[model samples]
Target: MKSSARSRLADRNGPLIPNIDIARPRPYLPRLLKHLFHPVFAFALICAVGCNPNGESASGKRKKERQKTAVVEQRDISFSISVAGEIGPAEQVSVRPEVNGRISELPVDIGDKVKSGDLLFALDDKDLQIELETRRTEIASANLEIRKAKQELDVADQEVELDLRRDSITRAKLEQQKAKDDHARNKILFDDELISKEVMQSVESAYELAKNAVLQAERNLQLSQERFRKAKERARTNYELATNAVLKAQRNLELTQDRLSETRIVAPFDCTVLTRSISAVGQAVSGSGGFNSGTEVMTIANLNEMIIDAHVNQADITRLSADMEVDVAVEAVIGLTVKGRVERIAPKATVRSGIKGFGARILLISVDARIQPGMTAKISIPVVSAENALSVPLAAVFTEQEGRYVYVVVDGVYEQRAVEVGVSDYRFAEILSGLNAGETVSLEMPGEDAEVKEMPAEKDKGKRG
Candidate 1:
């Protein structure tokens, strides 16, 4: 009956402990293990050990019981703020054509270093050349017209001189005087009755004829003078017109030459090509106009001088000023560092990356060839620094209604003392007064039961007053 009951129990439940042979001597067992062999009892034990009313565990409680303190000592303390910036050339320029034309020759391309006056690209000059020849031809034609007008002017002057000759008028006057003498002598003979009436009448008629001839000569001379004046004026006007045409043609020629020269674009300074927009030869570009800046052919920059554009946090901007030296590290180049100086700071604040900051430009004092534009870099700006100053960990300082204070350790007791603080950094604060070197201060607030006392600094101030 006992063997049947034990088999039924073993079948109903899984084995909790390894089974021992009944034939062999029974092994010794620990009392706890013997009790834990019961499944219900083992589960209760685990619950009692792990479950607690307080949230903290055993290790956490022990860690809280330890007091944290720091020793005040004279040490070198410094603080620096770092900001990310982008590397760029100090002087960058976008090259554009001044006159519209197709690019014929592109000598330099992206990444090419060029000097001032070096040819960068050229435009198709065949059309401009043909236009230039046309302008020259116009100028030559104008010169010929000018020469023809000058010859006509000379002829007009000669005609005026010839018209001024008094030969016909003088001959007419001489004939009129001879006819008057003959008329007078014939009248005297007729008065003496020694001449025929018909002869006298003929003499009178001759005198009248001579007078009409003189009048005609005078009118002809005056008419010729007027005609000569008009001809001379017309000739002068034609000459002036010809000269003006020549001037206009010359100006056109100069304009054509200027346009032709614009076909060849050259570098304005020593620079590196930052970008190239002209992909191939024969790319047509437009000239700058009233509303257009023209097509950009390329971008060049003075890579020898570089600058870092960074936005400094508003909290740290006040501590920075122009000409302040800083350290720059390139993100792309490992272990590369260079010196820089603050060149300018923005007068107003701007938002970048959801952060309000002031723009700052740092000129790289030490330029490296590997440093390229658009590369990201970090700039370290020194804000506050101290050397060999009495300092303590920042945690030791506390703020309350009384002011900044630290809990100093004295004779195994906590002393609440007021402190005058100076410059500070992330991990430490410089103690300007009310604290001395080789002093011990608590990092955390002391318990209420701990012996606490106020330092005699207040009393000392009273006595000094």
Candidate 2:
């Protein structure tokens, strides 16, 4: 029993020896844990202190220091106004027909340069010539009729004069016979005293018959004189009527000739032909409606004086004036800029698509060979400009209830600045006052102060260590 009791104690002691070896290594583990945990605990304490609301961290302090050293820049600014315009000739003359007629011969073609009084086209003159010849024949017939009437009047006057002379001689002979018979009758009366009284009565009857014949001859002479006067008057009236008829016919012939001359169209001034409407030589054209109502057989325009007709919006019209300088660019001839001036402005606004715009005419100060009529152009009008002026980005200027203002960084703090503005374009604004060159300005608004802090490089390295 003693031996068994000793063996049992040895077995319990042997297991206890292996457990002690493991326990010895466990003490070293506790020591390592203590060494690691002390530094972690200290780091936690430091983080808690720095993150507290009462105290600022190292990163926060560095951000404030950098803000104080920020800088800004000043730039020279320019302002310009741009508009789309069209290039055209300064003068445009529309060639229209005065009297309508068929285009018989078109002498000029498109792009032909012509001078004043140059023949442009001709109309058919066959009908006009025929009418003129007919009028001349009528005039000749009227003249022949007038000559016949005058000759008849002259014959009638000569006949009346001869009849007057014969009637006068007959009257004188009848008077002498009447005197002799009376005297003879008186002598017979004395002798008849012894004879019959019937013989004396016969002599007295012969004397009375002679007296009546003389009175009739005198009346015939007076009638001849009156007939001669009437014939002469009629002749004079016929001659006047015939002369007027001849004159009228002559006038009609002259008028037809003039119209025939007008058939040849001519240019009124120096110009270039823009178009030609007729080419076929045998094309039939109506005499009355061939080229009226602006149906141009050809078009000519003076290109030396070229002008641009631009439509300016009503909002910008108020700022325009005569003689203002402008730069024009034509789309047809690219990379060319022509100088021009505001020549005229329309008195009223024109509404197109419910937008109101006014017509403005721009005259080219100098002629350009590249500029042509109907070409589109882009116009730049300089409203105002300043050289070497204080300026900033347009985005930097912000409006408030007072006026324009900008945020300027001063001494690590953003301060609001009131600035006077002059002019602005798409990119920049001219700062008239309240800002200087080389000053720092913030492009973005600052958030909370804590949000702007940056992590320190030393802290990140220490954490890695």
Candidate 3:
């Protein structure tokens, strides 16, 4: 009965019992708890000691902290700005033909040197020559006509003078004959009855016939004089017309001769032949007014007076002014740099949609023998610069409500430094004051947690006092 009772009790408690091995030691909970609490307790004690208000005077302690926080360092810096540009000549010119013609004679080729007045090419002048000859012939004919007209005018003038003289003499003779016939008729009328009526009638008839003859002769002479005057006036008009025709013909002939001379192209100035499109002989060239008008027979340029034509951005043009110094480098002649200046800026900007920029041109200050026309070049314009100035990298400078400031490393602590700035470039800025050369400045400062505390009111009062 005792054993059964013991068995029943064991079964009832068996499900509730936890299994354990004698060889394995139980987990040390007390030890783990002590280990965890040890660090926490120590941290609390540290905070308590640090926060003690009476241990150290706040002002003295703050002063010590300030000393500890100040930072100091040293660095090297430079200030400069960079802009792109290109090299160009001081003077350059483009050469084109003045008259249109095919090239009959081309005396030079590319790179060939030529002097002023040198013949470059020739055009076929056959038509011009013929036209000039025709004009000259016309002038000769007009001149002969003028001479003939002058001779006719002189003869007409003499005939007019002779006719006037004849009119005067004949008029006087008619007047004398009329008077005599009147007198005879009056004297014979009274005696006619005695002398017989038939005889008197015959005398009167004779007188009348004679008087009519004299009058007729005078009228004929007057008509001849008027005819001579008209002939003289006609001759004078013809002579004048012939003279004007001769002058016009001569002028036309001269112009045609000039056109003929222009057919032989000549260099306007010393230049180099860049191209020759014609041969020496058998090449037919048309005149200026022909179908081959404006055709290029050859090309010439003044290579010695070369200029670089470069385009700069419009945004940068405002910073550029005339006479500003520049440096140029030609790709064709590498390792060589030429000096130049800003000669001019375009008033109106040229918008290039592809690049979304405008362009400007700069003139080279000087020339070099190696430089040639059409050579590619690069230019560097210093928009701003400083020498031996107190400067720092742009990153080291920052703005504040007070003004521009920099993080100066004062005795190993970052101290906010107020700085007056001057000229600055993209990479650097000139620090006018509050910083010295060789002094270290921070590019960045620690975050808010690392911020230095402000002094208390009492400390500030003492400092003011």
Candidate 4:
């Protein structure tokens, strides 16, 4: 009998087998097998299986694929502006000979270290020596002339005194003549018999003596006056000529001495000799020399200190100052970076390739021995550094009408969030506000096909329940 059936199945010929065995169970296995394999039962069993009809797996995958996101976290952020420049000596000069002559001696060679006043080269001073001796001789001769001039001046003074004496004699002769005239009148009165004999004799003697003295004075005065005039003329002429000779001698001496000093080339400051162009003992060089402006005997520079001449964009100039620290990396020195500070910034901008830039000088605080001039250096100027700041990949941030923003995933849905940005770099940007840490943000726009769809309120409630 079938399990669903309460009686045993009977065959067309009689019972194919006994309906029941008294010591065993009824023969219902065949009926039970047939019932279990019925189409309706199979349909009901297949339909009740745990297989999903809503494509929950596909929906889950779509939800995960809807967006690629990163968690917001705190990190140290910094900004820098890169510029190209060349390394050079802090102080450099082209050594030149101060005097025009053949180089007599060159004591210092290329790459030689030198101190202030150290000898680098010498000029042939034979001509200068001869000129110097000549000047010395001229000075000695000038001294003799000066003495002779002084002596003549003294003689001229005596002549002037003699001339005055001669003038006094002329005046005395006139007074004597008047006294003789008075004496002649008194003698006439005494001779007329009205005057005393003593008065007549006294007048006669005085007049005679005065007349004799006048004659002698006139002769002496004429000779002395003529002698003084000639002496004074000669003395004045000699003194002036002697004074001029002395001055000329002194000037020539100084010129010759200055030329002699120029023969030895001295180092203006402590430096390293970079190059030497003159080596032969007799190569003539001029201070302002041929082909090139002044003969450049050698090039010397202070190697202990170095500077970088960099071109900075005008837009970034405001962020730099003399005290601002900089990072310098020389291309020739691999993996080497040195610290430096801004030493100067050009006030005017230079136009290059239609862009404006300012020239800047960066002084290396501690220079390395390996660092040389003319190396190309890439410098990084520090702008700002923010520690423990909220930042995201630069790609994650976007700008729209609402301003800077990022896509945040909320309930598997992308929501636009506005953010305030601060310092930034090539890799990331700092978020100042409008966002919190640990929030997930989308790197790019999410595809609509991969997005999760929200159901109605009733359906959602039912699904939750």
Candidate 5:
């Protein structure tokens, strides 16, 4: 082994070492060979397995394949706004009684589907029915009295006509004058002894009787005129009274009928009853009149048309309006997605947890039987979307006190460049200025002596599970 070491050394430097004695190996030779040759073997093994075939370090290979970033390219970008909301019915109402009375029948129970004008509850209406009947009878009596009064007026008018015929003063005067002439002729005949005394007396008596008949007829006519006037006044007053009574009775009947109609509590629209508080058959209810709030019988909801009331941040409210498209997901119904549109954005803002936001209603376009009220809904609204715009990954965009910027790989070097950023959907941001299309950006900083791999940065990472 000694001569082999000398010959190997002589090969490198000729005649550098002199001849040495051929002796047995030393005691520490094993340890020396172990240490020396072990390093050489380890170096050969490392060259075979540990380093790249091209003589690059393992870390250099890793640097070559390190996570590369995306480029600022002209691509259609849609910035979405995420807000949490709950699914609810488009219409909900609490039912109450309109007339105060004892509940006679509560036919509809909880979870019962009902249509408009369907009877849900009934109140005791016996009193109203009796009152209506009494009003009707009064109306009949008034009509009968009106007929009687009209007949009395007719009789009074006929008597007035009879009196006018019997009391003619001019005819009475003519008869009296003729009687006087006849009596005077008879007296003259008696004085000349041509006629008897009884004849003149008889003529005078007939004239006097005719005159008295005329006076009695005139007096009877005056009395008949006064009586007829009084009868006419009385008849007019009685007819007016009867007609007014009829009007009053009719008004009363109408009021009673209105009250009777109130006794029936009908559904205002097609809905499903959610709750019912009234149970006993004889339970009392109150009317929603004056200051009374009335009793709540049940809660009814229209579940056919569902909506999601999403409270959006006030900062994003300006971008929302009527008919904005949206996507909705319900946790209760996994893997089911429904499309919707914004119905309205509330004018007023609501404060919750110190955050002020406007409530936006998203009306579901599709109807499903499995949908129910009060389900948690996740709403996605795309507020700002730009087509064929330069965009970059969000991680590449860094914020500073002045503005936003990104590290772009220019000439194989990371160049910190200023950039103008527009809307961001948390995964990618639209680049407005200070960056051009096809400019490569870095997701991470490479080491001082390392090369950056040209791998693309992942997009839409937030959407992944």
Candidate 6:
């Protein structure tokens, strides 16, 4: 009778309670009776043996039915490449002096905003000014020397005229003609027996002496002209040397003035001073000399426009192009997202830290004050995208020998169907054809024996649930 009753209870409750020998007599029969009759224990036993088939609880069946799957839906899907980069000003400059000098008057400091041509600093110009004065004095002295040489040249020219007049060549010629006439008259008389031979000889001697005087006069004139020519050449040379000296002095003066102007440095453009290398007003700085370029005086930048430098994986670099729009997020400023455009992409690939990638520059469409140089930025560049496309979880799609496919549930059975897939991100894949919205697809591969059915036509796609 006890066995029959225990079997009956097991049959009614579905075997959740263990077989206990409750029909046997025990010293703690009263305690056992009280515990077995408690409401909590009875309710727990009923809950354990829930009203479901095969002695399994309702929750067990629900859990078993919860296999990973996704429902196809019409949604926006895109493929993007995300990368980490750094933000910087589009135009930055390291300011330096053009000439070596001491900072005499520094007007701009770090963080100062300046307009184009505003004075940034000044160097001491006292020495240059003094040198410039000396150059002017030299030029004046050269002018005086030029004037003195001109006077000497005029005196030498006047001496040439004076010496020519003093030679008396005309007077010597007249005296020679008179002596020849007298000698001719005396010779005719001596030959005709009208004068003595001694007188004729004396007249001949006088004529010869007159001819010698004419020759002497011509020699004197030639010597004086040559001396005058030499003197004029010397004077003209002296004048040329003085003029050259003045030119040299003028050139030196111009150089000194140029250096003086350089003492005042001005801003090249409208910008903000980002750094100041000099601490005080008189720090010395080097200029471009030999192999040394110069001592950097300060740094400035135009903060209105900014750029992000990012390295993209070589596999994804081929998809990037100039002027392509992208999205940017600043790490320093939380929740700050802005639009950017691709400015350039490196032609060659570079390896950094054992990873090969291409360097790309992205220009910010708009810059925020909070975005600063050296700030970390995240860039999302879209390679491909689709709007309101029929899509499913990426895991739901699979590729096999027959091309890409998916296991879609139809009539409570997984049916393999070939699919035309488009762009896919990390989460969803765009279905170009072969699948319909409202259909369910298995996330994991179904059994090999699952029938591969012919997919619907393009017009009939997204019609079946």
TM-score of each: 0.73, 0.62, 0.64, 0.67, 0.66, 0.73
| lDDT by candidate, in order shown | 0.81, 0.65, 0.60, 0.75, 0.74, 0.78
Q: For candidate 1, what is the lDDT?
A: 0.81
Q: What TM-score does candidate 1 reach?
A: 0.73
lDDT of 1 by residue, 1-465 (tens): 013211211211221111212111222345556776698977766666588566555445555775478898877767666789999999999888888889889989899999999999998989889999999999999999999999999998886554444677888899999999999999999999999999999999999999998998898888888888898999999999999999999999999999888889888899999899989998899987536999999999999999999998887798789999999999999999999999999999999999899999999999988899999999987756778878888778775545567888988899988876665665677776777778899987777689999875442220111
Cα lDDT tens digits for candidate 5, 345-457: 98899997787999888999996787888888888766556677677776676544554456789788777676656544545666666666777877654557855443233
- Candidates 1 and 4 compared by lDDT, better number: 1
Clashing residue pairs in candidate 2 are 89-306, 89-307, 90-305, 90-306, 90-307
- Model 5 RMSD in Å is 20.6
Expressed as tens digits, the lDDT of each residue in 110-226 for candidate 3 is 778888998876766777778888998999899999999999988887775666667666776676587567647655664655566666666667676667767766777777877
Q: lDDT score, residue 39, model 3?
A: 80
lDDT of 4: 0.75
Candidate 2, residues 122-222, lDDT tens digits: the string is: 87778888888898898898888789777877776667575766767587676758666665866566586744556566666667767766776677777
Which of the two candidates, 5 or 6, achieves a greater lDDT against the reference? 6
Model 5 clashing residue pairs (backbone): 70-457
1-465 in candidate 4: lDDT tens per residue?
222111222333322111121111223446546766789976654554535475344334445675357888888877666788999999999988766889889988888899999998999999989999999999899889889888987877776667676676777788688887988788678879778988888877887777777777777777887777788778888888888998999999998898799888899999999989887788989875345577889999999999998888887788788878888998899998999999899989998667698989999998989899999999987666778878777667665544556777887887766666665555666676656778887777667664543222121210101
Query: lDDT, candidate 6, residue 116?
Result: 91
After superposition, the stretches of candidate 1 with alpha carbons farther than 4 Å from their true spots are 1-71, 76-85, 159-165, 289-291, 309-362, 376-387, 407-418, 440-465
What's the lDDT of the predicted structure labeled candidate 3? 0.60
Q: Which stretches of candidate 4 lie over 4 Å from their true place?
A: 1-71, 160-186, 189-223, 226-230, 289-293, 395-421, 433-465
RMSD of 3: 24.3
